[model samples]
Structures are given as C-alpha cells and as structure tokens.
Target: MKEILVLYYSHRGSVRALAEQIAHGIHQVPGAVARVRTVPRVSTVCEAVADDIPAEGPPYVEERDLAECIGLALGSPTRFGNMAAPMKYFLDGLAGAWVNGTLVGKPACVFTSTASLHGGQESTLLSMMLPLMHHGMLIAGLPYTEPALNETRSGGTPYGASHVAGQEGSAALSADEIALAQAQGRLLAGYALKLAVAR
Candidate 1:
C-alpha cells in the first residue's frame, strides 16, 4: 500500500484528533493508507530526554518515515501563531534530508488546532509549510469545492484543516471540522496516488 505520513505534535489532543480525522479520509481511497506518528515533547532542561518510545498513542517518528512516505500531512497546535517548539526542533533536524532531496516532488498538506476561534490557526499551518517547501514538496490546501469549508462555523479553512479547541483545550471536533479534515486527507491521498501513478 502507498503510505502518507501523518506527523503531528499535539499537547491537549486537539491536533491529534484532527490528525485521526484526516487519516480516516486517507483511508477512503483504495490502495492508500495513513502512517500516524508523533514527536517527543521538547524540554527547557538540558538533562531531560524523551524515552525511545512514547508510553501512549503513536510511536515517535523515525527518519525512515520521511524517507519512505509518498506524501505528508503535518499538524501542530498553534504556539504564538507558529508551530510548537518540539515540531520546529524536529523539522530543523532535516538538514540532511534537505540536502539529499528526500522529500522532493512529494505532495504535502498542513493542519493545526488552537484554543480560540481566532487563534492563528492559518498561520500555524503556513508555518509548517515553510520547512516542507524547503524540502521541495508540493503544498496543497482545501478548495471551496468542499461544502464544509463554506458551512463551517468553527474551524475549517482553505489553507488547511483546523480545529477550535476552546479555551479549556477540549479535543472534541465539530462536525464541520471533522468533515473538512477528512476532505483534506482524501485530497492529499488522491494527490499521492496520482503522482505515484504518473511516476
């Protein structure tokens, strides 16, 4: 099966919720599958280190995931209108992949979650794209053709999928938010399949 890497950093589970919904969409396409992975949290203390494998949820992402996947879906919680430090730290370590063009010509999509409805969701998605762009990947976003994008009152955008986690950091996704996220996954997987066939 062709795999699309679903990489995310989620603290309150909101971004991870969106990632699951997006993975569902990817599964809707035949011969396509989602490979969900998460990064370890960063710490300010110099002596702290994350375990080799996380205790819960998906396994920590490895370099092979990037080198093998046909496409990518990146997600993170909004951290002051940008991707969180852990996600940034992970991306910054891809210099060797950048030099080797490991991700070149691959299709990619971005997603984010925020505590408020106006909490820089789009900016976070855009920020994730910069590193993928540097890796020579093709960036895609939802088009207006998705009805949820027009009907969503909570957290869906043309730039990518998003969720309003509420001030209390709820992880429940709205109906429209779920629909849009699934739509994004389907779109991303579709692109990956098409490119694979073309090649």
Candidate 2:
C-alpha cells in the first residue's frame, strides 16, 4: 500500500474530525491507506514532558512516519492566524529530516479548524504549508471543480479544507466542510500515487 500520512494537532476534536474525513477519502483510492498520527502537546515548563504514549487518539508522529509515507495530510486548529504551538514545535524539530530530504518530492495538503468565520482558517493552512514547501514537498489545494468549495458557507478554501467551530469550539462540520475535506484527501492521494510512480 501507498500510505499517506494524515497527521494533525487538534484541540477540542474539531480538527480531528476533519482528519478522519480526510482519511476516509484517502481510503477511497484502491492502493492508498491513511496512516493517522498526532503530535504531543508542548509543555509550558522546560522540564515538563509528554508521555511516550498518548491516553487516546492516534499515536504520536515519528520521524519514521515522514520517511515512510508517500504523501501527507497535515491538520491543525488555528491559533492567532497560524498553526498551534504543538504542531509548530513538532515541525520545528524536524531539521534532521529536512537535511536528509525525508519528505522531498512527496505531495502534501493542509487543513485547519477555526473558532469563528474570520478565525484565520486560510492563514493557518498557509502557515502549515511553508515548512512542507521547505521540505521540497509539492503543495496541493482544492480546485474550483469541487462543488463543496463553491458551496460551503461554513469553512472551505481553495488553499485547503477547513471548519468553523463556533465560539465554544464544539460545532460539528457542515455537509460542505465534510465533502471538501474528503475531496482534498482524494486529490492528495491521487497526486501521491502518480508522484510515487514517477519517482
């Protein structure tokens, strides 16, 4: 199987829901599988550390996952028009992988969730893309062809898939959000398959 890593950092489960939908879309491809993973939270104190295993959800991402996957689906909740600290912290530590070209030429797509309509969803997605681009990965985005992109009133972007979780941060995805996310996944997996063959 050509595994596409569906990696994310989610708080309050909104981003996680999008990741699951992206994985479902990846699975729609015959030879593709989603390797779901998450990153540990960054601690405020210098001495604070996360457990080796999380209490729930997907396993923490390893450098090996980057090397193994043929493609990537990156997701995070928005933080001040950017990706959350934990996800940024994880990406910042990947200097070794960056040098080794562990992710070079792989296809990548980003996703995000926000607290309000103007909560920086697109900026968050774009922020996630910078590091992937630095790694020499090809960035993919939703096209106008996806009906959801045109129809979504909640959260969807040509830059990536997104969701608007309301002020309390518990809103479920609208139908269009789900559709666009799945389409983004399928598009990413298709790119990965073709790119893998080309490589």
Candidate 3:
C-alpha cells in the first residue's frame, strides 16, 4: 500500500475536520492509505519547542514523512487570507527537502478553513500550494466536473477543498463541502497511484 500524507495545522478544528474527510476519501481508493500528520503551533515571542508528540489528534509532522509519502494533502486555517503561521514556518524549514527533491514528482492537493464565507478560502489554498509547487509536486485541484463543486453554497472551490467556520469557529461542514473534499482526496490518490508507476 502507498501512503498519502495528509498534513495540516488547524487552529479551530475545522481544518482538521477537512483533513479527516480527505483521508477518508483516500481510503476509498484501493492501494492508497492516508498518513495523517499535523504541525505544532508557533510562538510569536520566539521559537518554542513543542512536545515530541502532541497531546491531542495527529502527531507532529516530520521531514521524513514528505520523503516517504507517495502523495500529499496539505491543509490549514486561514489567517488574514493565507495559511496560518505555523504551517508557513514548517514549510519554510524544508529547504533540505527542496534541495534533495524529496517531494519531486509527487502529487499534492491543498485545503483550508476560513471564519467567514468570503474569508480567503481560495487564497489560503493557493498559499499552501506555492511551497508544494516549489518542491516540484504536481498540484491536483477540484474540477468543476464534481457535482458538489457546482452545488456547494458553503465551501467547495475549483482551487481546492475548504470550509467556513463562522465567527465562533463552530460551523460544521456542509454536505457539499464534505463531498468535494472527499472527491479532492480521491482525485489526488488516483494521480499519485498512476504517477508512482511512471516514476
């Protein structure tokens, strides 16, 4: 079985919810498994060391996960229309992987959560994609062919999967958001499976 890395830094659990849905979709495809991981929160004062293992959901991501996974799904919460600082800090530290081409030729997709309907969901997804693109990973996006892309009133986008968390960050994903996210995952896994053979 090949593993697809589902990596994210969720602030209010919304992005994490999307990551889980994406992983669920990856599982639907045979021969593709999800390796879910999360990045630690960053400190504004100075660099702080997080516990080796998180107290909650997924474990913190390691550089090796990028090297080992056949594909990637990167998710994050929107902070001023971009990915949160923690996710960006993690990506900024990947120069070694960039030089080694650890993620070259791999398939990747992006996801995000925003506090408002127009809270930069697409921009956040695009922000996360930039680093992956620099790493030479092929970006896989949600196509309009998906019915949910046409039907969603909440959070589906042609750029990627996304969710609207509302002000208190308590909004649950709508059915359309769920379907679109899962479809993105399956699409990414399909690309990974086919590309692995070519490589």
Candidate 4:
C-alpha cells in the first residue's frame, strides 16, 4: 500500500477537522492510505516542553514519516498570514531532509484555517509551500475544475483547501470547503499512486 502523510497542527481543532476529511479522501483511492500525524505546540517560555505524545490526537511527526510516505498533505492554522509557529518550527528542523532530497519529486499539498473570510488563507498556504519546495516536492493544488472552488463562499482556494472558523471560532466548515478538501486529497493520492507504479 502507498501511504500519504497527513500532517498538521490545530489550535481550535479546525485544521485537524480538515485534515481528517483529507485523509478520508485519500483512503478513497485504491492502494493509497493516509498516515495521520500532528506536531506539538511551541512554547513561549524558554525550556518549556510538551509530552512526547499528545494526550489525545495523533502522535508528533518525525523525519521518518517524511521518508516513508508517498505523498504529503500539510495543514496548519493561519497565524498572521503565515503558518503557525509550531508548523514552521517543525519545517525548520527539516534541513537534513532538504539536503538529502528525501522529499524530492513527491507530491505535496497544504491546507489552513482562519478566523475570518479575509484572514489570509491563501498566503498561509503559499508560505507553507516554500519549505516543501526547498525540499523538492512537487506542489499540488486544487484546480478550478473542482466545482467547490467556484461555489465556496467561506474558505476554499486554488492554492489548497481552507476554512473560515468565524470570530468565536465556531463556524463549521462549509460543504464546499469539505468537498474541495476531499477532492484535493483524492487528486494527490491518485497522482502519487501513479508515480509509485511508474517507479
């Protein structure tokens, strides 16, 4: 079976919600499976640490996950128009993988959530792509043909799947957002399976 890593960080559970939908789509493709993982939160105070394993949710990701996966789906909540500090911190620690080209030619996509409709989902997605590009992964995105991209009023984007969590962070993901995310995952898994077979 070909495994696609679904890695993410979620604060209010919005990004994790999207990640699960993406994983569900990945499983829709024959011979493809999703390996869900999450990163730990960063601490502001010096020397602060999180448990090696999260209390609930997926375990913290490791470099081995990147090496073993056929493709990647990265997610994080938007933080000031960029990926959250925890996700960025995790990526920054991947210089060894970048140098070794471990992710080269792999298909990768990004997803994000924000508090408002105008809360920089596209920019956050773009920002997350930069490190993957450096690691030589091929960036995958939602095409306009995925009708949900055109119909979404809340948070779908050409860059990737997204969600607007509202001011109090209570807004559920719109149906269009869910559809687009699933479509992106299926497309990525299909492409990865094709490449694996070709190899």
Compute the lDDT for candidate 1.
Answer: 0.94
lDDT of 2 at 3: 97
Query: Candidate 4 lDDT, tens digit per residue, 85-142?
Result: 9999999999899888899989999999999889999899999999999898889999
Per-residue lDDT, model 4, residue 59, is: 89
Q: For residues 55-115, what per-residue lDDT tens digits would candidate 2 score against the true structure?
A: 8999999999999999999999999999999999999999999999999999999999998
TM-score of 2: 0.97
Q: lDDT of all the models against the reference?
A: 0.94, 0.94, 0.92, 0.92
Instruction: Give a tens-digit lDDT track for model 1, residues 1-199.
Output: 9999999999999999999999999999999999999998887662276577898999989888998899999999999999999999999998889999999999999999999989999888888899999999999999999999999999998999999989899999999999999999999999999997886
Total backbone clashes of model 2?
Answer: 0
- Poorest lDDT segment (10 consecutive residues) of candidate 1: 43-52
Model 4 segments beyond 4 Å from truth?
44-49
Candidate 3 C-alpha lDDT tens digits along 78-130: 99999999999999999999999999999999999988999998888887889
Clash number for every model? 0, 0, 0, 0
- RMSD list, candidates in order: 1.1, 1.2, 1.3, 1.3
- Spell out the clash pairs found in candidate 4: none
**Model 3 error, position 116 (Å):** 0.6
